[model samples]
Target: MSLKRSLNRALAATTGLQVRKAPRPSAPPPPPAAPVYHEPAAEDRLLRRPVFVISSIRSGSTLLRMMLDTHSRLRAPHELHISRLEVGYGSSVSEYAMQNLGLERGDLEHLLWDRVLHRELVRSGKDFIVEKTPGNVFCHERIRDSWPDARFLVLLRHPESIARSWHESDPAKRPYEKAVTDVLRHVEAVDRARETLDDACTVRYEDITADPGRELRRLCRFLGLDYEPGMVDYGRKGDPELKRGLGDWRANIRTGTVQPGRALPGSGEVHPALLPYCDSWGYTS
Candidate 1:
């Protein structure tokens, strides 16, 4: 008998059990990863090195937008929400035509976004443009692909404060619990951007509100623009008034003065759902 069979038979006869082979150890699961995107050829796009602000709702991005908008060389328009813009083929024949032309739905949408922003920059007579749409945090990589030379500013705020402000923005429609869930999406997205986008700049709402001029100077350095005094006193320059859908319309923003941000929420007061993000952003400690 084969030695293996003899051993198995002996074990079965002696102990009423066969020599059972151990199952192989499973390979460790791969680490969690984010999607990777590549930019299209240079000829495919119009805009270059445009700045985008990646932030959560109610993170004081509107206030920063107003400041940047006042810069002579830079234009910071209201929330463009351009990433949500999508393209669709009208028919299968059209889709086939586009496929043959080497254009996909995403590629077409990227072209549209680039052209739209380029038109805005041309109209404003500015050398550079900055867009501050909060939802862009979720699609930083896609934006990078669209404008291979895109710059980003990752805006952050205390997680609890963001959720509270969102709820209070429309209390009747957005209850506290729902607000936490909704805002958590943004908070997590911001964290992801911070973790992944090493080239992006990061600033806190509290820091911006605490010292407007200083923060504006820092931002100017990042954007490669001279710090214009007009950007510091944006209110006096007759900026576009705060429209409801475009950005913060609260009396504070309308007042055109940088107001101090609310105190950070105590650890005990933070929602459990937001704790992990809070920790990730260094808000808890």
Candidate 2:
């Protein structure tokens, strides 16, 4: 203690100041790192916006499907025929599943529908899927309920054109009256959905084919995709298995062309019942 005190006194004498220790200076902490944003994986994007086509039968939906599928990253194949299972008192799988396994309805629906979609997307090696089932116009509501982010395209052919096609093109399978009635119902649905859903859009057969360059480019814009040249020549690159499955619509596609679908002027005989819906959807001319 004596030696330490002597050393302290000597240092103080030499310095001519107090021997109190000086505090160390501190550096400011570095600024917090900025948050990083990452884009979703392709599979996740497909889940978010599974391309579901909804349109009346014989409305040129196949053409639209093929076009979209031609995009290097898009896969629009034949009718997956997504059924509406959410309706009916006895139809809901969830109630029974809940009673038995205590599984949530949302979980069950996702497993039944979204999981199948995910598996199919993985299988096809495509980043996205566009399911083209004309009959699916009826199931539009259910599809939206299932995947809230689903992108839907509704093809609108002239009602007279659709009615005539059904009568002349598909007479063997269903009655003309049934076709007309079904078209009317589907048209009503399309109109309603167009009004309600921002993601759901209507594509006129006339517009797309008339200006494939412009309309298709516009469509690509709507889809948040870059326009691809192959989209216009989808027939050349179309899937054979899918082509055969489209019933009579395959006849035109078989020609390996993407020409505008033309019916002989006056080929269509407009029924009175279809007038209201046809007029409303902008097909009067």
Q: What is the TM-score of each candidate against the true structure?
A: 0.82, 0.71
Cα lDDT, model 2, residue 79: 74
Backbone collisions counted per model:
0, 0
Give Cα distance to truth, residue 36, candidate 2, Å. Answer: 39
TM-score for candidate 2, residues paired by index? 0.71
Instruction: Show where candidate 1 strays beyond 4 Å.
Output: 1-38, 236-240
Where is the poorest 10-residue window by lDDT in model 1?
A: 31-40
Model 1, span 1-285: residue lDDT tens: 888889999998989888777999999999744422245898887777899999999999999998888888888888888987777778999988977878777778888899989999999998888999898888888888788798999999889999999999999999999999999898888888888889988898988988888888888898888888777566732335667888887777876678778888874999999988887787773
Model 1 accuracy (lDDT, Cα): 0.85
What's the alpha carbon RMSD for model 2?
A: 25.9
Residue pairs in clash, model 2: none
- Candidate 2 stretches with Cα past 4 Å from truth are 1-46, 84-107, 172-175, 236-240, 243-249, 263-269
Error of 1 at 51 (Å): 0.5
